[model samples]
Target: MLITFIISSALLTLITLAPLLPSNHWTVRVWEFPRLQIVFLILINILLMALLIAQDLGPFLALVIVNLCLLCYQINWIFPYTPFANTTVKMSKSSDLSSRIKVINVNVLMSNRDAHKLIALVEQHQPHLLVTLESNQWWQDALEPLHDAYPYRVNYPLDNLYGMHLFSRIPLSDITTAERVEQGVPSIHCIANLHNGKQIQCHFLHPAPPSPTENEESTERDIELLGLAREIANKQGSDSLPVLVSGDLNDVAWSPTTQAFLRISGLQDPRIGRGAYNTFHAQYAFARWPLDHIFHSEHFELVSLSRLSEIGSDHFPLLTEIHLK
Candidate 1:
């Protein structure tokens, strides 16, 4: 029991400290996703160690102190996502439907064949914009019926898992599909004309994640995000256009990269002070994080934010409504 406790504590400590390193390698970056899980394990370790403290007083006390500090550190990063923290985006006070933008963002697992579930969700929600990631040619065909309701569309279907599609009830113009960092991975950018005749810039991204099976490093993902942030900052500086960025960012909302993206772009995350709203790993509640995100500029305020029911994919869909302020 003593040996097992020590090993678990040591491993938890290492994982807690891993993300603080500056390396963008997959081995290191992957550890950033499970801070909540680590906190849970650390608490268990502390309890177990407390029971066995008599056997090894000095070492057990030292481990407890270290774990306590680590617990505080992990909580600091996640606290803002809890309801205790003040909301970064203010709540909407407007009742005008024309000033509101409703969005549904989903990452349909590339090989999952349950298209009807997602289609049903779109019909139920009837969002102004629907963004789908990892959608290939088959998924595109399955979603064809939506064209009647969502007349404005941006489709770039590919066999690659990074394919993205955008369907809009609102008019979309200046649509561009660009390969920001990687050649095959595509992201969609466009201007959405709201019912009130206001134009808001919308960007949909599905950057490659850092993993052994995918890109070995997070450089490309970071570059794509930070690059887009710079562009949005510059554009807003010039025209002060309202902007909304949504998709499977492949990074957790609490990660350093995402924090930097929010700061640089001056965008507001509705998740902050609301809830984590973990979207990925729909099959396993224990192994989930908020990977799908919807961020907006100061021009918008949150009307509603929710993690919708599962649609037979690795990720749950996110439905967000923001009122133009």
Candidate 2:
């Protein structure tokens, strides 16, 4: 019984972490691989445990081979090859970066009290562009001091979970809610004019989380963002303007769909070599992952990226500085 319990717990742990495995096989990965492999292993374990309870050794030993294969395949998680890994290869050729830009993204839990923490973080980072998710009128009021620092603002603070506010030191032109899906669930799309006369088309999004309370299915949000990413990729192959799509994607970086988003969008993940800048579940440090992200087109270079201190919310603020060449 003890051995059965041990095997069951181990298998459950493996299943949970399975999705974080690397997916650059040029074959199959993440959802298609890990999720399938995990389900198969869990069933096998259950069958083997039942056999063991019945004093059946033959089936248990046969299941051992399946367990071994699953364990071996699990090694892909040791290193995830994201676009950030590709940065070094292109660095030598990017020597003519003219101007730099800084961006900060945060998801302040709608009912959080540490509004001052976010305010201080903005003051400290002094980012050129800032985006806050799950914000309401209360949050907007708490962060009012930032209005002076960032003269140009696009505030849409609503009680709904989709509320988002964007503050930028640079001039934001043609500011409007992106019409990817429908109303209520808002996403900000704007063209930012930098001090260097360069302009970047930016998309700040907060997709619905795949939880029972928020969103029952993730299809709409996933497809909406993917469609946006695909549009950006089409532009990337022709245009010179920098493009960035950022916010809490609510999906793991190593997921198969996210990999497809990368393949389809042609955007680069900024957290490859930097390690997982886990920024959720602030109260429990161990229960966090890099839900917040900043993916950019090839027209920019990363200057710096950081996860700010806890702001009494469920997520930590992500600050990124980049230079356009």
Candidate 3:
């Protein structure tokens, strides 16, 4: 038992620290998604080691210490999502009706056909803007009901899972879509009108995740996100508009690449000090992470962030309300 615990504990400890290297290999990048699960494993392993202390006291002590360190590193990255941390975007203290904007982002699992669930959410929340990922021609037809309410839209539906669609009640101008990282994987860039007649620069993305079925490495995702971040940060420097990027980022909020993107873009994450707001794996409680995200500039203040009811898709809808300060 002691021998087994030591070997497993040591291995887990190394896996936990793998992402720290400046590498985007699939093996290293994949480690970014399971920090929370690793923490649980570390805790349980520590308890097992303590109970089996009779085997090799010295080795067990070293393993326990390493596990503890790994635990701290993982928690530090996630601490921003906890209530104890301070929020990056502050909601307006005043009841400013004209400056408010509501946006919802959802990733409709490509194979799932529950269009009504998503349409119902749009009706219930009445978001100023709605962005959908993994959308296709059928999903577009199912969502036709939104046209009456949201006259302005940009749709790029495809049978491939990388499809995207955006609908807004407010006018959308300067709209364009691009395949930032790989061909056929499009990202939307546009400007939306706020209640007070202000223009908010918006960018929506659904970066391909690093997986065996998809790209074998995180290179494409990182390049796409970071490249856009640099551009947004450049325009954001003028400080004339409130830049907002919302969609299924396909990356966790706490990952190193995500943090680097934020720093490069100078965009503020509303999830900071709020909560994990895990949107993926709607069906599984054991395996989940905050994959969908809304990152905006410091020009706006956060109002409320909440997860909507399950829509039969693997991801639940995320609703965010913000006040343009």
lDDT of candidate 3 vs native? 0.88
Tell me which of candidates 1 and 3 scores higher on TM-score.
1
Task: List clashing residue pairs in candidate 1.
Answer: none
Please write out the lDDT profile of model 3 over residues 183-289, one tens digit for every residue.
98999999998767898999999999988898888899989899998897777556568889988888999998899999998899998887899987999988889
Colliding residue pairs in candidate 2: none
How many clashing pairs per prediction, in order? 0, 0, 0
- Residue range 173-232, candidate 1, lDDT tens digits: 899999978999999999999877899999999999999999999999999999999988
Q: In model 2, where do residues sit more than 4 Å from their true spots? A: 1-68, 71-78, 81-98
Give a tens-digit lDDT track for model 2, residues 1-325: 6466566746556565544555322222223323433545665675656666567555466445555555455434413533344343133234443477789999998999788888888888789998999999999898888999899998888898778999998899978886466467788998999876889989998877555576655566677778887787777646557888888877666565677887888778777755667777678754555778888877777778788898988888889887776
Q: How accurate is candidate 1 locally (lDDT)?
A: 0.91
**What lDDT score is found at residue 218 in candidate 2?**
59
RMSD vs true structure, all candidates: 1.4, 6.5, 1.7
Question: Which numbered prediction scores highest in TM-score against the true structure?
Answer: 1
Number of residue pairs clashing in candidate 1, backbone atoms closer than 3 angstroms, sequence gap of 3 or more or interchain: 0
Arrange candidates by TM-score, descending.
1, 3, 2
